[model samples]
Target: MPGSITGTIVDPTGAAVAGARVRISHGDQSAEQEALSGDDGQYSLPNVTPGPFQLTITLVGFTTQASSGILRSGENYTVPQIAMPLATAVTEVRVVPSRVEVAEDQIKAQEKQRVLGVVPNFYVSYDHHAVPLAPKQKFELAWKTTVDPVSFGVTGAIAGIQQAQNDFSGYGQGAQGYGKRFGASYANFVASTYIGGAILPSLLKQDPRYFYKGAGSKRSRVLYAIANSVICKGDNGHWQANYSSILGSLAAGGISNLYYPAKNRDGAELTFENTLIGISESAAVNLLQEFFIRKLTRNIPNYEPVSP
Candidate 1:
């Protein structure tokens, strides 16, 4: 006499698992039959000369389940609904190497962060889900900023301001001084930017770009930006002490004192003092960033996970 066994396969979520491979074997007289669960997760195997039997089910991304049971000949049987545990996804994801490709995709997305449809706001990542940039990526972004035409234009404006203030008297007044100041100013910008934003950041294993936290209460946003100037995202995509900014600012200040007039020079003590001032100044700027910059600017991408 022949009997039949019927069962269903489902996940812990109780979702029907179609295409799951179900195997049934009974001693040397084992009969193997496969049933793909329907959308309803129902699988049925019929016409078995039942005796001592074992049932197993396997699915990709799922653990295998095995059951041993006895069946009486000529008796219809229903196995209790089978529940297959989910195979862990972590190990499978770890084996894949799409990291660089993922970063490149993110960088491409970041390159579009602009302001008012005109100004280059490339350094801002609207993505709260950003990945750590590779060293080469850091340099690439720095090179992009350094060579940007807007960067040169902005540097020219700073040079004009320095000449207006007679900031570098050592170079003397007029066109020569203006040109000298321009070179120095541009160099300063480039050095500080590349060193702090790219070179040193890559070396120190930091992330140079500002991670936009465009949410929370007003006070929280203010505090967040201020805290960020002294603490920054690491290359591992974590927030850490911003040694790169503090040291970069100090280095730039000391180097600037070399070219300024002796009378105008900030001494070693003054340099250190200036570095402190720089940090404070950054806080002020960060405050403005938290409170004002977004409004003054436009065309900012809306990839920020939430709104402030």
Candidate 2:
């Protein structure tokens, strides 16, 4: 004679689990019986060979469960209600910004930086691990610097001084001379800024911004600042000779000869002299940035200090 097995399946909340698979197998026999739980979660297997048997219950989105028992011939064995726990779901998420996007964000922060809350300090990167800028960003920064009101004011001041000193005497006196001097000065500024800060840096894969070294002894910081005048961070993040600034100064000086009074143009001599002066100016400005400018700069991000 054969026996029967019956059971009800439920969820952890005790609600009926319909359409769940219920399978019964005997250890001694190679045969198995299977059934699907009804809408009320009831399931039954009739005429199952009686012996030692195991029941497995399976459903989507729930853990598989099993029960075991020994059945006597012609007995109706009922299993305790089986409750299936919900399966734990696993989900993975990843978020990452591209290098160009990161650089653009950093540039936006830098653009807000101003010295004494007035002058733009856009070329300085307070973030020690700042990402490299693309060629388009380089040009954008240069354009911003060139169009800044302070840049125009500084150029005007330089022109006024040159006019008072009669520095380029061939331009003569009065408003006409001042106009010529202003135009020449502004042209020089535009040429040098774009060439050194944008064009050459783009071509040479160099960074034009001065990276602040905020965690070091005064002497070490000073040396770093001076060295940076002739050596800059490469796009690859290694320090390399700053050929962009060096050559840019020479090129700007050579270009100035095209407009300057012939008497003032000293050819190659003037070019080299201007290049040396540019280097010296860079060193001085870098020193100011390391020691004093950061304190005076507004809208600066709270960046971690980098060690030497």
Per-prediction TM-score, please? 0.64, 0.75
TM-score of 2: 0.75
Please list the residue runs of candidate 1 whose C-alpha ends up more than 4 Å from where it truly belongs after superposition. Answer: 1-97, 261-263, 296-299, 306-308
List, residue by residue over 95-189, the lDDT tens digit for candidate 2: 79999999999998998899999899999999989999999999999998899999899999999999999989999989999999999999999
Query: Compared with the true structure, what per-residue lDDT tens digits does model 1 show for residues 158-188?
Result: 9898888877678788888888888888887
For model 2, name the residue pairs that clash.
none
How far off is residue 295 in model 2, in Å?
0.8
Candidate 1: pairs in clash: 116-298
In order, how many clashes per candidate? 1, 0
Q: What does candidate 1 score in Cα RMSD to the true structure?
A: 12.2
